[model samples]
Target: MEQVTTVGIDLAKRVFALHGADGAGRAVLRRTLRRDQVMEAVAALPPCVIGMEAGSGAHEWARRFRTLGHTPKLMAAKFVAPYRRNGKNDGNDAEAICEAVSRPGMRFVPIKSLEQQALLSLHRVRQGFIAERTGTINRLRGLLTEFGVVLPLRSVIVRRDASKAAEALPGLARRAIDDLLAHLRVLDERIAAYDRELEAQARGCEPAQRLMKIRGVGTLSALAIVATVGDARDFKSGRQFAAWLGLTPRQHSSGGKSRLGHITKRGDAYLRCLLVQGARSVLHTATRHADRMSRWVQGVETRRGYHRALVAIASKNARIAWALLSRNEELRIE
Candidate 1:
């Protein structure tokens, strides 16, 4: 039977380290596998439990392992950190991963699908281009001001008036202005192309369409939620999802009384940032508003102020999103 009951795989770009244990958790197998060798080796052993960290291509491997009759578990890297003994290496990491997977109450990471990773890649790249565009716009505006040519107050105006401003500048400033405009044009084209590609992707997925029903959630939020949560079924409730996003208050407990601190600020920072920004947009742009959630946000804003209000709304939105997704419930703009 070869009797490999538990296995830990330390995954990397090329080579991977493996540690297999018997039913009693005694080390019985230690091996190194090239990327191509991973599947067949595990498949050859009897059905057993397998563990790996949750990052980069982890879900694909998890799916593959399961298909081979293995019970695969994905653990957060932070949860597995306590298992590390001393000097770090693949073998040591594999052992730590194995130990962490055996814990009774440990919360495991949900594996993401290939489509999810692909969509997230598009988002990450688009964000980079957007950031670059912002910097370019700021630089252009500041440089023009130094040359006694000031554009209007708006970003859209600055973009449209660049050529007109350039025409008015003297020779030295004119050439510089033209160079900056060239960069802006390139950035604008790239950003537009990425947006089109993302919109195409969003239309094809039901999860994205569902997410778009929320007040603040737009194309970006819809896509992000769908891609990030490969299986909404894994989350017990919507509040769990909100907590996972670190949208909820931090915990500080002792004795019978429990006090929550500021938000934990854990989990996907980019996702959190997008959700908060979306909340801000909904706060300002929406014309009709009078609901329990909105009223709560209004009250919070009066006491705590704008920044805190923004965070509270973001957290509330996260919770609502989870509820809507997990229950297959529709979003109501309030």
Candidate 2:
């Protein structure tokens, strides 16, 4: 006991490791608890700062701990790794988390609300469906090619010609092709349904609606950003927000010489992908519109070439999104 002031728990499925420190940062408690005993154990202790890595079940635990009068700090696993000493066991990990959470400059992850997690669930499932559909399409193409029926790379063309090509194949091969095409059709329907649901959600969400007004930010991109980034204000600046999404360049500096490389591509790969795709959309149609953003995009395209222009627009859009979400401001087309 010794009046615990801070604690860290290494989370797991069945067993957990706990480390506790007193006011003077001296280790006062170290133990393990089973899954069912965790809540009761923590409830017995006085309210204190609890820290854990941002991973599976971390948010739920954080939410629950808040109700028990405990302050929960969730840190990225990598940040906690350096603090760990000796072997990689639950006890050492918990101890490291205890040490890391007390650091004044250490960053913490924002706890996600149930509503936000729910919307993100939809995104994850929809992405899975899309990936499955892509694999199915590729399989269909590969199967057809083996039977001397060459189809173009386009899905639309495959949909049109697949049936005719299948009709000319041998009996079992034809049946197999038919089945895959049917499966593809089912996946398409499911994906479309998810798209409609997301569109409705975006329509109802004020933040998402505002985000959609930004060029190249469609329903999916807006919703993804909103759901993934719980509170934009957690970021000190738009540049920081962009850096969090791994849209900013990585640095390799030493001896006071500055060196910048490609994007670190470190955080939230899905969100980064969505923003980059939106940037590509902006780049393709920049010539059609005379708006300031379009003009700037065109200039970047000309000066930096296509690929760098994409990153420029993506990073810029990320910054604008941060401003919109954090400051509650409207987009100004100037």
Question: Residue by residue across 241-261, what tens digits does model 1's lDDT show?
Answer: 877888888888989899988
TM-score for all predictions?
A: 0.86, 0.96
Query: For each candidate, C-alpha RMSD in Å?
Result: 3.1, 1.3
Off by over 4 Å in 1: 138-154, 157-177, 255-257, 285-288, 332-334
lDDT of candidates 1 onward, in order? 0.84, 0.92
Give residue 154's error in model 1 in angstroms: 5.8
Give every collision pair in model 1.
Answer: none
**lDDT at position 326, candidate 1:** 78
Q: Model 1 misses residue 232 by how many Å?
A: 1.2
Poorest 10 consecutive residues by lDDT, candidate 1: 285-294
Model 2 Cα shift for residue 99 (angstroms): 1.5
**Residue 165 error, candidate 1, Å:** 6.4
